[model samples]
Target: MRVDLHPFAGIGWPGRERCGPMRRCLPQLRDSRVGIFGVGSALAPHVSRQLDLLPALVPALEHGSPRERLARRIFDNACIDERRFCIPDFRHGTRKVLYDTLHPGLGRRMAVYRREAPRLAASACEPALKSARVAADEITHLVVVTCTGIFTPGPDVELAERLSLQSDVERTIVGFMGCSGAFHGMRVARRAALERNARVLLVCVELCSLHQRDEAGAGALVAQSIFADGATAVVLGAIRDHDRTLALLGEDRTCLEPGTRAALTWEMRDDGFAVRLSPELPSLVEGRVARFVTPLLDGIDPQVRPAWIVHPGGAAILRAVQRGLGLERDDLASAWSVLRRLGNTSSSAVLYVLEEALARLAVGAEGVMLGFGPGLTFEALRFQRGPGV
Candidate 1:
């Protein structure tokens, strides 16, 4: 195997002292054939269907203000039937714990994240390891991706210990990359496997509910209505004689759209993080979807329509992708089902849809996965189903 040395392999990078202890060598996975051996996901225990939760939220939002009206419209059109939350009180009608005078500080939110993220990661990882028929110590690397929480001794380290991985296993934490983070994680794992021939464990866990703000504005209300908590784990390695799952062949990412930099943003605040979502986000994506994505899709196969596994940013975002790709609604049934059941689990959203798609994907079927994030970026992965799941 050709092991590519990172730039700072032996000698630390300049200004390394200024960086935090959590910093490590950059992941140097290069282009190679990597098999996705297994995928497993876990949802928080607290669940609430939309029918019960939306009515309960009416009182928290203004009874008749424009924000309230906008929230009602957003929720009515959300197409999400239910979502799971790590916080018990956010379930359905129990709004007083979070919505009433509860401006949870950043510290409190981080505390919850530190406590819950590892458990969720473990819950997902265990099943994945089992499916891959691999043990904890056999994992040569651990990669954890998240956008909702920040803490030293972060989820990556915690998950490694929780799973009893080797003390010196290479580690990486791809943080704050927004909804598209999971795709980045997959790329990282693919590289690790292809470069060093290492089996990589990848986990993406987000507790978006922990960063909730009680603000009554359209952005806050809309974010609250759609975001939730979930985690997913996948085992990746170089394709071998025994490897027979979906193989990640290649990926494409688009440059940020002009003047749309701030369309979707996640910012840290003293009293938890604030989400700034533009109402025009759907339209912006729709306008550029074809131009940005058609080339990528055509590169995979000009004649065949690969299954479109899209990120469930929301109802509108999914529709925008569909219209952009000239795909029918039925083409996005898995994406819609994930959104309806799990809401947008931030970085885990696309993986959830991929898991649903994997179950029904037939051998010889081609696939295209897409995710959008803060850069107004679009990330796509092209893959083909192997003989076995």
Candidate 2:
């Protein structure tokens, strides 16, 4: 279904007439009062223009080889216009010529991540806090999620300092969960928002560029073609008076397509992490997503057909999910927009899609946010647009 990103976009349900009657009639919407007040996302300054990627990949490909042709074809067909990067050289520089000589070890990559990830996280979070009218000191818990980079005094610790959050604020960092990692963080914030006097801040940041490798294999080429750096922040709390936000409804998490574990995997190597994406992943998802997502929506009220906010892991994944769910292309417009504009920002991607979806949502509108990661895992959360400011 097509979703419009505007204040007066969807069918309106005035005042308590929105959730009050629906909650009683449909138990699924009964207790969903927690809301997301604001969402902010930021891309790094270094951008790879639309035509820059193919030329950059050309030098990496082996001359006069079939594999090289395949690599070029993959990059050409990735459906990405441009992508921002945390590493300057990955953008418009001579890095292509020096790529073979540059072997950034794990230590070097970690150094860059430790120095930059928090800055990007804070940049995204500050505006969210301001937009929500939430003071840094007022936030009781902080949740940071990432799988791209790891270093102590992690982004969580540094963000608390950078954002000037309270000294005793509770903090949690979710690591190595790949793209769906932010869903785990959102789940944490969802629980925190349920507590009295608690305001939650969730930050998702990924410096996928720092993990770039010189390998020209299919997996590496796929990783290089799609991954980019980005950060997003979300403010969540129990619904308050006059709050214009999206309600935090129930969530469902599951591991699907067993024995397909080798289809997608991410592991740490000496020179950054490695990604192995089997060619079968897209078709596997296409075949299984319907069964996987159907149960998540089964118990919800049939009248509240939630809009879909899917993680655009790649163009293929988006197409796979759309067919699996019997949805039209417009249903995934936000996802496609984010992927074309920013590529896959790993864990921060779903948050970007959510931000866009919420922007277009009208009061009492419902939506579903889905993300996939390692373990062939799927994280799905149901949300409803609540009252306006």
> What value does the lDDT take at residue 175 in candidate 2?
89
Clashes of each: 1, 2
Give the whole-model CA lDDT for all candidates, comma-separated: 0.77, 0.77
How do the residues 13-32 of candidate 1 rate in per-residue lDDT, one tens digit apiece? 23212212222222212232
Report the Cα lDDT for candidate 1: 0.77
* Candidate 2 residue lDDT tens string, 1-389: 22222221122223222112122233365466777887788879778864576555345666658977777678778888899977667555455322444676888788888888998999999988987888999999999999988877778889998999999899999888888898888878888888898999999999887776768777777877888899999888887666666555654545544667888899999977888888888887776665455544545556555688899899889988877676778889999999999999999998889888777888777777888888787667766776643
Candidate 1 off by > 4 Å:
1-32, 54-60, 64-67, 92-101, 299-303
Judge candidate 2 against the unseen true structure and give its global Cα lDDT, from 0 to 1. 0.77
TM-score of 2: 0.87
TM-score, one value per model: 0.87, 0.87
- Checking candidate 2 for backbone clashes, the offending pairs are 5-360, 6-360
